[model samples]
Target: MEILHHDVRAHNVMLGINCIVQLTNFETARPQSGGKSWPLKDKDEILRWTAPEKDSSETRYTSECDVFSFGVLLWEIVSQTRPFDKIKNGREVFKKKILIGERPNINMHMKDGHQISVASDNYFKIMTEAWSQEANHRPSMSSICERLRNIFHTNINEDEIEYTENPSKENDITALDPLTQTTTSENILTSNENNVKSKEEILLEKARQYHDAKDYSNAWSIYNNLLESDKGNAEVKFMVGSYLVHGPPYCQNNDIDKAENYLREAADDGYAKAQYLYYQLLFNKAGKYLKLAANQNYTEALYDHGYHLYKGTFERRDPAKGAESLIAAHYQLHNNALGKLNELEKRYAKEKKLKKE
Candidate 1:
């Protein structure tokens, strides 16, 4: 009857002999009366559990959010695999499809002497109701607990438990015991291992090889594949954006609009490099790309920005701005390059004096 954790993972849940469900992962949990919002930034993970109406700005989350999340957990427990695994970029896109009333498929089987069906329309109805987009329409935590208690009392049987599989293999479905139709641990483990891959490692290796050979086209292709695999992968997104911004040959010939799009995507994903690049590209259109680069905190970006500003390629000739940029460049220069920025600063000062005279 008591809550243990808000970040409940599969390993944290335990069923007791008295049919009591003990939960864990309550690091962020607060009293019901406390007006604290869950500090989650990525809505994608919670989308499947969220009600269709609650997807808006006006609706604030309560324990009902946990209800939605629990429905997904139940689905995972019954199905033996993560929901929407077959659907690429599932987390990012699940909310849109769920709002349209798309439901997870369920099937019926026999265990022991009892008939069990995890895919009952009633289950989906309850889940959808719990996840209703409107917070007011969704059931409260106490109500959800009551409903679950009733289901467990009626459906659970200690004797004659059996396991069976769903006819359709769309999801990893399995029956738990000979009498009870639920997913088995062995089947779930097998299905998970068979499906998921180390996408980051795969993409990183491809990029390394391509970059080493200076084959930017192939590098870009690998990065694009990774992006399609996991849109939330900020590192890959940044690499792809960097290639588009500074890549040679094919990428160079690509339209500025396309390059900007990729850079913007990376920037939005929180890649600092992408943010600097995006800022530069925006200013580049107005011949101010160089100055923006110098303003970046990174030394390399500062040097490049200073170089562009001093050259007056993007903006009107301004000796003062050029001198300031060069001074910044001088501070960032390492080893033998120190003289380069200093020399540029000296040259700009002389030019400014001559212009004034």
Candidate 2:
């Protein structure tokens, strides 16, 4: 479904917890068929932010209209002031002015009155391109995001960034964040609380890319950093622990004890996957961990926990009830578990026949 917000403007975007900007005011939002378009709507939006084509006639406005609105919104972001603030009757003036292709002037201070240093010329050029009269000429949202990323994070290598059109065939860098729009008040990431969140995102993405590229040593090195200390993310903990358990070639020669401990740490932090995987790996040896995962009804653990209950394998036995639960969970992906299920069915039938005879 192609969901249109209908309203795209500076005020519609607000900073939420963790310095993340979220879009609001979805009162006029509606879903369009994948390839179909929506007619012009939401005329009450800031007149300066409306696309020229949208204003010129009662033409069908598509996602491209939001692109035009975003171009004007970028002015609000850069100038940090309402467009045409100098003129009286600015509201009515901008509506007519935009129809003839007028747009806000890009400036220094952001809408919040905070001054920002220009990092790249492409930034302003991108802003101008978004306001291109022809909607087809405007850069796609993906392209806009990449330009914003390069500006936001200065060290971003052009080679590492993914492109929407005409992607390079050789050594393509798989994008970690796709279709996720993030906007800030220019210098917001530098603020104290948001800095930590920003660092976590950067480090997490770093580890993810290294892992995807099979740069195991570097991936593990980063994972190790995220694994240690109180600042470790639960996902990081689960990842290291799961990696240790499964030993994907990078983490081959699995460390049973370390995996259990790492996964246990995340389980303590209330991570469900960590609970289940840890339970599966250590249930026989560590019943407590099994119960921890079992409590969450983790799929594989449910089957294993029920199987153990049936056979009295490190748990209280109730063969009839447990077998029913075991078959109900029906974990077929794991070869060993599949074999056990088949064996249990055969044994159960044999015993039943013998009892009848």
Candidate 3:
């Protein structure tokens, strides 16, 4: 019944036809319950997966502690790297960081036009909640297992696998030059013989080429022309919205109103990025937009919400609140912003000390 022990890392995991399990070194396995104190003489060994409060005489080990360890294990699997590897003698350092409310990050990549994380954000979020500082806040192992099962059930689609096996030819054909006519092969060969360019094709090609060259102005211009000609092209509208909102140089002007307008258009077309950006602008002004973005459970907007709470730039400043936001952002790849926030924390602490003087 023992699924894993303390010494186990992700490499020990074995996936069978129906069951996934792990084998661990029992020498490192401390009793999960009814332990008077950690029997290990060296604090370092116990420190590896122990929570910050584990050393306190008042604290006792429990299954909930195992849940914390499970969170670390999950982090290892997703990152394909050791937890807390960034800190030297990282085991203890990681323990301290987690005690102070640090959370492991989820690695992500753009795949098939969708952002995919090494582990789903929902899974990490559940694990994080289950490993909260207060013992009562932690979920029972059975509950954790149920939540994880639901996450996999809802997020993992067999249809995705099937679709990946046979990708749509439409996207592939977009790369083809319209001037070249071919029925079977998608290749578009260079031919001096062709002179005419279809308006739609010309706009698409111009946008693609400009994007490839990182020339947003020309691309924006071409897209604007296309939009004027065919105002109903949802895809073109989405492109213009995205370019106007996020495009470099010109778009960097931070024209929130224009950004909001274009982003709204794209969001209406169901573009997740546009929805996320629009939510940020709205949330930045007032809390009204939080419901819209939060409802979708958009990871980016969640990170922003947490970050705004942490920065307290436009709101109230609370380190604990900011730390919580940073922790949530960590799961969503927004943790990079925490470095500046941490510096601000140190400055605030120093100022408080000076005031006491």
Candidate 1 residue runs with Cα over 4 Å from true position: 1-20, 41-43, 88-91, 107-125, 156-357
Could you arrange the candidates by TM-score from highest to lowest? 2, 3, 1
- TM-score of each model, in listed order: 0.34, 0.41, 0.37
What do the candidate models score in CA lDDT, each in turn? 0.60, 0.68, 0.60
Residues 33-89, model 1: lDDT tens digits: 655556645446545555555567576545666666666666766676655667666
Per-residue C-alpha lDDT of model 2 across residues 287-307, encoded as one tens digit per residue? 666656766767677677767
Candidate 3, run of 10 with poorest lDDT: 184-193
What is the C-alpha lDDT profile of model 3 across 1-357, one tens digit per residue?
A: 433254434644677654646454465465554334335544454454555556565766566666777666766666677666666564556456767877655544235678655447677777577657776787776677656654553344433331112334576644465654463233222231143344555566757787688866556656666777666666666667666655476343445566577678878888776677778767666754753574465656655555666556546866676566555656666656467457757877898899999
Query: Which stretches in model 3 have alpha-carbon errors above 4 Å?
Result: 1-12, 16-19, 30-48, 91-96, 106-119, 159-357
**Which predicted model would earn the best TM-score?**
2
Candidate 3: RMSD to truth: 24.8
- The candidate maximizing lDDT is 2
